[model samples]
Target chain A: MAIPKDKMLEMLHSLLLSRRFEEALTELCQVEGKIPGMMILCTGQEAVGAGVCAALRPGDVIITNHRSHAHLLAKGADPKVLMAEIYGKRTGCNKGKSGTLHLALPEIGAPCTSTVVGAGPPMAVGRAFAQQYRGEPAVTVCFVGDGATGEGSFHEALNLASLWNLPVIFVCENNCYAGAQRLEEHTRIENIADRAAAYCMPGVVVDGNDAPAIYTTALDARARAAAGQGPTLIECKTYRWRGHGESDPQHYQPKEEIAAWRARCPVARMREAVLALGLISTDDLSAMETKVDALVREAIRFAEESPYPEPREALEDVYA
Target chain B: MPQLTVGQALNQALREEMTRDDTVFIAGEGVGVSIHDNPMLPTAGLLRDFGPRRVRDTPVSEAAIAGLAVGAAEAGLKPVVEIMFNPFFTLASDMIVNHAAKLRYLSGGKSAFPLVVRIKSGAGFSAGCQHSHNLEAWTAHCPGLKVVMPATAADAKGLLKSAIRDPNPVVFFEDMMLYFAPGPVPEDEYLLPIGQADVKRPGRDVTVVTWSRMLGVAFKAAEQLAAEGIDLEIVDLRTLAPLDKETVLASVRKTGRLVVLHEATRTGGFAGEVAAVVMEEAFESLKAPLRRVTGPDIPVPASPPLERFYIPDAEQVITAVKDIM
Candidate 1:
């Protein structure tokens, strides 16, 4: 299925913005030491979040994992508040409580993100179950890393979603590693999507680095869910260019592998594709890059300028 | 008012809440089919009354069951889910503890996770440690959760109703042995506030703090002790978290003696918490060292005789009270 040039441009913009925001965050956390906590970045895996979220509507629910900035950006979460959260500012989406790992924007249908591996799917099932119970046509999208697939929670979630024929899409970003452990070392299965057949759901594998490919797959999954066809497992085989968390030295992964994945950057690929469509020029792409850079800088400035919550605020959110 | 079992009271609460609000639903394994075939158990006729959409019978997936409640609650629906056995709560703890309990706080108080997780607990049926363990302390320790264990039919109905309406996650524990025990339940609908203690019996000699089925043991011991002229005042803490420390301390101050009683094993039991509170707040008023009448620090054995021994009985309560006296 061919995507329109306008939608492609929008996705290209989201890709650029996500890449620029993360790059700025990395600098703040690593060089400047401004950000705190264990922040995980979606450096090279931008296409999966951008493409999949672009296929969804604003009201569609999304259950995010620890590496969640890209998906939140694609789903229209305010980057300024997200950055403020990373800075532990009171202006943050979670009022400095969630930090970077557990940010959520419920108004946009992206509830709290789970830092626990394999936890999002079961909650996604609940969100979908609520949607179905309320007779709403909205679908729920659950994002997880390849490592999450090995969790028993993930399997249980899949079984229940299928058994109930609920509207949910499980998007597994196969970045070839679960933390420092490579895919082969962690899971014996060659294709994570193949496990969907065991649960009697459609299994589709897409190119993780290819935005159009992932968008197409996610669109079909969303449609199937809308038609009451239950869930579909879409595995996007991608790679992360950075370490699992901010503190990791990444001695486990080879330099050559990182360099190779870096060469296949999703942002550059989407930019080139947009340029090839002849709807935008190199200058236009450059202008877009400059704008995205400014947006990231503004978000950082907002976060830095924001005040930390009072110590007593920690006791505030424990109950309703 | 009518005489009803705790199970019947719980059923009345569920039925009333579901009828009052369309958003309230019940989900669990065999909730709809009544697989246990115990008419006294809640959800006995719920599937037929509320239909499958509200009274869902799910697979034996505790984690998913709890997670579903978390999501549903977050989505603005009030979900009251069940874990067949309290010990099985270990499987569902991640969703209940990590997600439901923390989501509201983690959302910076921007969200309210209004849900209830109903669990059947207590040891006496020889269901072994896995099915019979009373782990209220596990949940009560968490900040965001409200833990409740009701001993009477009226409190069961009233508390469950309040829990369903509460705009936070609540862990409601029902004793398996109390399912058929008869108590007076009001016919009209009513709600009990969480985090309050009830003075079951009033006396000044000794204060015995307990809840759930352990209340029966305390009451039985009180009867035997009354004949001996060592009067016992009983305090039932309906809500464990947001503990009614004022009530507990007041009772301790009046009696000038205290005994914490529970069926859970001693080491990490909530009884220790009660004892600590007394030591900290009522130390000057205490006439004797605080005593804990709790089960041994060991897993509940499956053998009937051994299980009976594993559970703290009225004899233990009486002995602890006498020792303090």
Candidate 2:
């Protein structure tokens, strides 16, 4: 799909904003001890989240696993709420009760994200099933990592989705590794998309760093789902810019491999492409950066000022 | 009104609810098949009647079975999941504890799970340690879950119907041993609210609280004791969580003696929790300390002789009631 010049610039701006936001969070973790330890940076994987979310309407549902900051941001969740959740403050989504691993925003239809591997797939199927049963046009998008494909729930969820013809889009952010183990070391299949054939569903592979490519693929899948063609599996080929979590030193990945991926950084490449096309002026780009920086600063201030939940509140909310 | 067994009553309740509401459905393993033509016979014709969409036979993945039920319930479906054996509940604790029980509260009261989990509990028929274990106490400890253990056919039907209609997650425990136990059941549709305790056989001497298969044992013990002029008040705790402390305390105040019974192991059993409640609420009303008659703190044995020894029978209940008196 050929991207419109204006849309291309918009994608570039969004990716850069996500990149800068994550960078700021990383620095905040160092100086203020805000994020506890080493954090997973969605540096190279920004395009997949940004592209897919951009195609979704406001009421459309999105579910994701542990590696989810980019997805939440892409779905328009306030950075303040996201940051406050990470800081475990009441101002956070889920009232800081669900931390980073399990944040929820019902207003945006991002109900909650699960930390358990492959848990979101079945939930996404459930949501899609509900939409189907209610005759609602809303679609449910589930974001999972390559590691999740190994889980039995993933297979069960896919089969159920196919059987029910649920309007669900399964986006596999294949970052090449499940923690430190590479995809080749785990599954016999070269592409996770190939597994979709067994379920008789459309499966596509895309350069996850290419925003237009991901957005076009996701758009096509969404159309197919809306037309009652059942679920689609979109395997996003990307790389994680940081270790699995904040704690990993990443001795498993070679320095050259890291360097090679860094050269194709989603944000930097998109920004250069937009600049070369003259779609956005340098002043407009700098102003956008300044605005994002100010927004992040305000969010941090709001999070820092938010109250810690009362100790007695722990016993509350265990039931309705 | 008509008489029915506990199993038949439960099946009737499920059928009625599924007929009344389009959102209600059944899911689990061996639900569509009549295992031994007794345990799953209640659900035998349900699949054929309701079709595969409403009556599903899930794979032997307990976690997925439970997780799918939770997901479906959250999406506004009233799903009743059958966990063939009670001990297998441990595999689905993530859905039971973290998902179903907490979804409403976590959603800030914006969501109601309305899921029902049906499982067979207790030691009998030589179904050893794993299959026969009673874990009501474990489930009752959780805040959001409503635990129900019906001792009679009427309660089995009424309570199961209410659980399907309830807007919260409920764990419905059925005693495998009581599947053949018969009692009076109303033919017309009815509902029994969760958290109510029923006084099966009222007396003035000592109060005996029990549930599930042990209710029968308590009743037998009361009957035997009545012959000796030792009138016993038997309170069937149909629901474990949201316990009817009012009924228990009122009975305790009048009798001034208490005996709690269960087929589960003594330590950390539901009996212990009942004892704690009695001590906390009606300490001054007690003529004697609360006595608990329960299974020994060990795995249920597979042999018939050893299984008989593993569970508390009528004699044990009589002894515990007399000791309290």
Candidate 3:
């Protein structure tokens, strides 16, 4: 299922938006202790979020992980509120509760995010089960990292998703590091998707830098899921440019490897793909960046000006 | 206006709730297929009535089912999931505590996880260590979860209904040993408050604070105590997390003594929590140091002799009460 050029370009726009948004958020986080919590920026893996969410319908659901800003933004969450949430402001997405590690906007079918490595898969499987139970032709996407493959929660969810033939897609954003521990340090499998075979599901590996590959793969997974087929594991081989969290030395990742991955940045790669397809020129791309920058600036300003939630609110929202 | 066993009562509550709301569903192992064709199974008649979709029989994937229930609950469904026994609950703790319990709080009130996790607990069946841990303390320890353990069939029926309708995620611990115990249940549909306590037998000498199947031991001990001059007030703490301290406090204040009992190991059992609360809140009212009749701090043995000795019986409760008195 090839995505139309228009849809591909739209995914490009989303990719750019996600990249710029993270860059801006990272910049703000660096501004002399402005943010409350550590930032796990999904910088290099924008295409995985952009292309996958682009293929999804508005009614479909996604459960993201800690480095979830890009995924949530790509899924059409309000950037201003998401930023405010990280800022611990009352106007934030989760009323100043979730912060960065846990951010969810149920209104956009992007519900709660589980920071535990493999937590999102089970929840995604659950929502997919609900969708199937209700007979709603809605696909549920569970976004995890390569580290999650080492976690039992991921395999547990996969087994259930396959056993029940749930309408779910497991997207492993294989950024290769589980907090300074490389993929080799964690598991023996060369591909996280390969583990899907154990669950009796199709596993596919794609270049995380290629927006078209992600978009087309996501569409195929969604179609298969909606058609009553079981889950598919799509491992997007990507890289995180920064430290796992904000500043602890990234001594584990070799500088050469980081530089190599930087050259294949998803946003830049998507831009070149779109350009080669004659969808846009450098001038149009530059203009799009400017617009994205303005939106990010507006979100930052919205976050900065928003009031911190009242201390008493700590007691609220626990029930109901 | 019907005599119902705990299992029958629970089944009726599940049926009534499922019939009342299409959004409510039951999913668990053997929920669809009753074990040994027991018509009185807690989840009996549910599958045939609600079909496979609503009354799902899951594989032994406790974590997946728990996570699935939490996800479905967040996505606008009332899901009641059973983990055949309480020990398996530890496998699903990540979902129950890390996700379901914390989601509404973490989501900043953006979503409601109207999910109930039914864990059958108690140590009488020689089910061994793995199946015997009553981790109500584990659930009650978590801030975001509402943990309820019903001691009677009526309370089981009422509380299960309430847990299903509740807007928060609830871990309902149904006593395994008490499943066949019969009691009077109301014919009309009703829901009990989640965190309320019931004073099953009011007295003025000593307050016996207990919950779940331990209430049976407390009752038996009370019978022996009544034969003497001792008057024992039995306070059944149906809910653990959002504890009804007020009820326990009032009972303790009136009786002027307390004995907290549970089948869970004594180290970190819900018994300690209840005992501590009475000490903190009703310290002046205590005429004797509070006591606890709980399983020793040891893994429940599978052997009949060891398991029998491990569990607190009527004698233990009586002795604990005597010491408190």
Q: Please, what is the whole-model Cα lDDT of each candidate in the order they appear?
A: 0.92, 0.82, 0.88
Top candidate by TM-score: 1
Which candidate would rank higher by TM-score, 1 or 3? 1
- Candidate 3 wrong stretches, greater than 4 Å: B34-37
- Deviating ranges (above 4 Å) for candidate 2: A3-10, A32-41, A180-190, A194-203, A275-283, B33-44, B108-110, B187-189
TM-score of chain A of 2: 0.95
lDDT tens digits, residues A1-320, model 3? 54587797788878877887787777788888678878888888888989899889978999999989778888998789988888889999999889988898999988869888789988998899889889998999999998888878788889999998999999999998989889998888898888988989999999987878888899999999999988999999999888898775789889999999999988888788788878888898789888887888889999999999989999998887
- The docking quality of candidate 2, as DockQ, is 0.40
Root-mean-square deviation of Cα positions for candidate 2 versus the true structure, in angstroms: 3.1
Model 2 earns a TM-score of 0.90
Q: Compose the digit string of candidate 2's lDDT tens values, residues A121-172.
A: 8777767766776677778899999999998878878887887788899999
Can you tell me the CAPRI class of model 2?
acceptable
**Candidate 3 chain B: worst-modelled 10 consecutive residues by lDDT:** B33-42
Residue-level lDDT of model 1, residues A85-199, one tens digit each, is 9899999999999999898889788995899999999899999999999989899999999999988889999999999999999999999888889999997899999999999
Model 2: reference contacts kept, as a fraction:
0.26
Candidate 2 per-residue C-alpha lDDT over B1-325 given as tens digits, one digit per residue, 9 for 90 to 100: 7878888888889899999998888878888764555643457688878888788777676776776677667778888888989998987776787777875665545567888999878788787888888889899988899999999999999999999988889999999778788889998688988899999988999999999888888888988999999999999999998899999999999999999989999889988888888999999999988888999999999999998988898898888777766
Candidate 2 local lDDT, residue B283: 97
